[model samples]
Target: MTWFLISIAALIGGYFIYGTFVEKVFGINEKLATPAHAQNDGVDYVPMSTPKVYLVQLLNIAGVGPIFGPIMGALYGPAALLWIVIGCVFAGAVHDYFSGMLSVRNNGASVPTITGRYLGNGAKHFMNIFAIILLLLVGVVFVSAPAGMLTNLANEQGGLEISKTTMVVAIFAYYIIATIVPVDKIIGRFYPLFGALLIFMSVGLITAVGFSSEHTIMGGYAISDMFTNLNPNDMPLWPALFITIACGAISGFHATQSPLMARCMKNEKNGRFVFYGAMIGEGVIAIIWCTLALSFFGSVDALSDAVHNGGPGNVVYSSSFGLLGTFGGILAFLGVVILPITSGDTAFRSSRLILAEYFNMEQKSLNKRLLMAVPLFVIGAILTQVDFGIIWRYFGFANQSTATIMLWTAAAYLLRHNKLHWICTVPAVFMTTVCIAFIMNNATLGFGLPMTISTTIGIVSALAITAYVVKVSKGKGDTELADEEKPKSAPETV
Candidate 1:
């Protein structure tokens, strides 16, 4: 209970303290015209109020990441609390802010295009393909997870039964339509509704956990207990925890989603509120769910048993029902069902935009959008037949890996401008370490190397990248970095 309360305090306090410092360092200028005003198309690039943009940004990034990831992460003990709080404020929020602000400054270019501008085409091309694949994986995972959940609920209730394949078809169809539609049509308008439900769920869970005497305060591991790995599998806390806990802490995928809102932001000053603020909000949600899982289950062993018996989805449902009853079940439905659908659609939309930006294809028309999306959705649908567990494992590695690349891009942008590059460079180096260690130590991906060997490789990789980035920065004057030309807007593919 004490740790939970302090984690909550950290999120709120970080926004006012560190968030403000970051806002100032990024040098927000309200007077500066954002891409929304500079490049409004009445479609994807229309300006929106800060609040609406904040909601969309929040929902887009939140998905099942904070809820589901942290539930699983809770298995690692109270250490999840440390990572979500500290990681969100320092690493995650910082990553989101730089990525969003960079897009706003660069004509709302996708991360890939921005990477291309700062790094070379080689890096840009790799990121472009990597990001799209990651987004597609996200789309597929979200669709399957929700569809499977709905199927379970139908079976349990014995009403309105639906096959998983049918749910997949319906969800993918929605993704295709959402992808091709303009921003204001489906996503911009309805995202707030979803955002409200998400907030309600977060608040509901937090309230339930706080009020329940049976909640078993400090049920699992305390802060002191966190120093050792309590994971049932003895999963090392280093790479596994960081990678598993990405969204609540920091995710590379947020960089892709930021450009969607970046196109709609009317002023540069709103970037902090929209990007940094949303990440902190997500951290709060993650903390709530993780707390509920730990408190309601009464012990780490109990929580693990619940997870093993019914999976993470069951953890959510049983915890919610156990606390708030029927309404809690509704919240569980929202978290388990609706949240992923919202993110899944946007993932596809972002992919469309990235592809359009990459080929310099204008997205003002439906044909151009569909041309990019049809094949993408088909591939996503095909992926639904494959086991979701495998897809998600790859997705975790890919998601953080993409974030590592974006951090490098952000670091390069800061260096070229001769601004303080350490903010991004340091986190970039750390995540660089995390990604490498996870890749090397995982039995599925690597040779099941010892954590010691993996840690050494991770450290070396991080130091090498840092040295190279610094060396490249030293060779070029600030003017040279600034003079790296931005891409010209592509001709409208009418």
Candidate 2:
């Protein structure tokens, strides 16, 4: 309980301290016109209230990642609490704030376009393909998971009897509408309500945990036990815990989603609240759900057993419905069903904007919007037919891989500007090593080499990249700056 409280306080306190410091470093200039005001298309680039933008951005990034990832990561023990608090305060929130502000400063360019400017044209092209693929996987997976859950819920209730196929079609229809319409129309209006549900669910769980007399649920294995993996499966703490808890910690997907809000923000000052503050809010939510999962089951062993018996979704269902009864059922429905559906729609929406920016196509007209969206949704619909497990496994890898790119790109941007480049550079190097280690050590992809060899390679690769970055920064500072801001034009040789 002490560990949990400390983690909660750290996340909250982080916003005022580290979050504010980051805001200062970025130097928000409210007098400057944002992309929303500079290019108000009404369709995509529409200014919104800061609160609305914050809520949308929070829900957009949160989705199922923070909740589900932490639940699984909890199997590794309380190491998750440490990661959520530390990573959210430093790496994840900083990554998000910089991503959003950089986009706002550069006319709401997508992550790939931004990467092209700071990294190079070659890196940019690669990120373009990677971001699109990751987004499609996210859209398809979020769509299938929620639709299947909703179908099951309906079946269990013995009521309206919506088939999984029908739910997919209905959900996809909502996605299409959300994608094609103006930013302020469907998304702006409905997301606040969905955001309310998300917050309420967390509040309910936190209250239940706080008031409960069952210390057994909260006892056993202090937070320090998390330093070593306690999983019965003996999963490595390095890459497995990092990837499993991506949202609560750090995720490249948030960088992609940041531009969506960047285009809608009314002030640069709001970047701190919308991007950094939202990540902290997500950390709080993750802490609530993670602690609740452990407390509800009375032990990490029981929680792991529940996860093995069904999946994260079953754990979500059991914890919510089983604990809170009918109220819990409603919260479970929102967690297992509604939240992912919201994220799924926005995933497609972000994909549309990304493709538009990539092709230098105008999206002011409905025809142009449909032209970009139709093929994407068609592909997403087709992907929905694929196995969810395969898509999820690939997504976990792809998500962190994307984050590694964003961190390095951000580091490069800072280096070119002669700011404290290490802010982004250090985390970038660490995550680069993690990504390499994951690919080299995972059972499916590599030889499943010994940890010693994998760690050695990871360290060497990370140092090599960091040294290259430092070497490049000195000679090409001005050249890099010239390329950093111009997204549509081909990048200058650095």
Candidate 3:
């Protein structure tokens, strides 16, 4: 029965969420423009074919979050997957698709740029600062949590000496590859080949594990029982669930991904497939990983043992691939590397866009090596000293706050221009309400809230700014603003 409900929810979510990408919410056809074209620079600004763009965008946005978030969400029982699937389609997918479309229409402007142009300079600067802080936090959490997970994997199966230095070297190698390789060429030629190999390996691993006699299927525990059994000092399901879904459902990073891909999309018609399809792919990955975690761990005690002795990565890898012996373990390790590399690349690209926009650097003229190298090193170094578990917890709340602010900005824009679509508005409202509710609950319960103080402050400031923008916008009247700039036609087909 639970599986049935989950299936239905997934289908519904996938359809609606993916549908938004296909259905142009804003009639964006007229607004698409020829992206400022230049010579192929073999690095950051390499022009990509539509298919290549789609793959890179998909791989970039769908990464470790799908795996880690779902594993964490499983603590609330399989029921949480329902919310993760639904919220992602309605909220996360919408935000990503439209944000990308908006960016593409504006010639690859970041969210803050779009907010600034549509909202105001004050809102733009504020959001930019907020985004940078969020990115750093995300980078810290991203690198450390995954590194810890990798460390765990190494210790258990490979019987290899897993240390911080080795993990750091592996991550550095990934960044170097990402820096020199043109994303277009990589996605166009290498990604398809690698993606196919990854899919086959992932399926084989799942099948091998599933068929193994070593696995056990216990009746899933109730969320209430699960929490009651936990130590009071430990993080609870309610807060953890909120944090887990923050990325899959809503994340500021999506805003960055959306715009860059939107610019490269051959036609606005492809947006639906690339944007929404990628999101659904992410959700599916999350669901699979979470199920693996639950099946492998079996109980909270087992989970704790893995975490305490091996770390979260150990818990994740053992639970995920333990049933399949050596092959499973190797596959799992390789999978971990692939997933994080995709994420790191996306993060690097998004961070570069934000920095370039902030400093008024020509998008095409920016140096990819410096852009990728500096942030990757800085984030990697910062992560080495931090406790990733705590950072992971904070990621949820901070991500929710970032999503909330972005949605609010989008909602205000729609309402102000009287161009509001129910599709976008509904998700915006739903996401905002849920995030705000989660924030309030976490704060009241003294669960340390999922986000940092900086994020909390940013959310509050964004709300105030949004409210003021709306109020001022109302006074100016929609007609005046609408007349200020005419909507352009979509760029002519190549």
Candidate 4:
């Protein structure tokens, strides 16, 4: 499932790039272009090629969540892969693509702004509140997962307790660089190189595990045995699956990425490539991580032991690096550190943009800094204390709920415009149904109803938003709608 998804994502990413450059040939005029507003002269608003945007999007979306979520989700047997792939293509990617394209068309507005435009002021308010809640949940879980990874690395490599202070310092340093560096330059020069190294390391690790003579089982029983034999007291399938998808599937963080990248697009026609394209890439990465986990560990029982006795990061490192020699293990460790830095940078920048827009503050102003500091500090403190595995589950659920709502909004918009066929509506429908099913499963299995409750509320909100958008589209004929804004023409080479 992991390899299949990654392959699809890579193809989509490539297609999106090709499509972006060919927009003129497609007769997509300036009228359909993404509008630019509140443009930043700094790092956030730099215009980048479709490929670069895709890389940033991929890096931002592919983080520790995918690694942990699928490994844990595997406890439900291979049955869980059904939800991950279905959700990724339909619910997850669709929500990301459309939300991004819509935001671009509306002057790089965040999801809340787009929701307000089509849904109504009330829907906007609800979406904003929901988005923020979801963001915090995501931040908390992501933060802890990486920190735990580092702790485990320190324990294994040095046989010493890793200080929270060292982790905090490392995080702070990464964020400082992320804030100062230009994303375009980073993507163009470093992203692909870094990506290549990571892939090579991953391939090496996967090869090692495949050839190992230790504990081999026939007909995939080794994988199945891992799940069936897990400690009975651990969280059960229904809730675990829900949590897994939530962390790995569609997330609110994508909402932030969509709008930021939308502003970089040269025209509206690039939407299919940039928005949908990057999502497919992310799905593929998720697949790779999943495959690595299953093939390397051979059982959920082994994975759980690593997490409990050694730590989750140990499970990851031991699995990926254990296959390689000491050098390979160290490489895996560095990659893990780099992964979070890339993701954290994107998240922080997006969070800053969203907060600045919401409060109508200057991007670099002291007020914006003050507003962001509290959330960042609070999130950091939470990471220092919480059990990341549980937090990841919550984050996954909240993210899927948000994606479910966004998909409904996109579907309604497309249907109203009679562009439903062009849009990826099939994926949208699948995501919505699966998310609801997972939510229902969670409820029946006695997981606290918080995530399910949020999802249920999102379903209601999506319905209301869709109805409102349709009503508005009817009132103002589609032909009368304003043209989407476009960027100024690029200068010709001398």
Top candidate on TM-score is 1
- Tell me how far the alpha carbon of residue 37 in candidate 2 is from the true structure, in angstroms, after superposition: 0.7
lDDT of 4 by residue, 424-461 (tens): 34444445554564665565433335655746754664
- Which tens-of-lDDT digit does each residue in 1-494 have in candidate 3? 24523644674567565565436445545344434232223445445566667666766776667766665565555655666677777777767776776665566677888777666788788888777666656655656655666676677666988896687667766655564455565544666555654564456554654665665432355545433424223555543465665655556667766765665565665666677666665666665665565556776556556556655456556654565557766665666556666666566667666887787765443464476457646765766577666666565666666676566666665666566545655665555555554665565434344455534643565456556656755544356355423444444454
Candidate 4 residue spans exceeding 4 A from truth: 1-40, 158-161, 180-190, 213-242, 247-249, 267-273, 307-311, 364-375, 421-480, 485-494
Residue-level lDDT tens digits of model 2 in 110-191: 9999888777898889999999999999899788888877786777655776789998999899999998999889888989
The number of clashing residue pairs in each candidate reads 0, 0, 12, 11
> Per-candidate RMSD vs. true structure?
3.5, 4.1, 4.9, 5.2
Per-model TM-score, in order, reads 0.95, 0.94, 0.80, 0.79
Name the 10 consecutive residues with the lowest summed lDDT in model 3.
32-41
RMSD of 1: 3.5
Query: Candidate 1, clashing residue pairs?
Result: none
Question: Which residue runs does candidate 1 get wrong by more than 4 Å?
Answer: 217-220, 475-494
lDDT of candidates 1 onward, in order: 0.83, 0.82, 0.60, 0.58
Error of 2 at 485 (Å): 9.9
Full ranking by lDDT: 1, 2, 3, 4
On the 0 to 100 scale, the lDDT of residue 188 in model 2 is 89
Backbone clash tally for model 4?
11
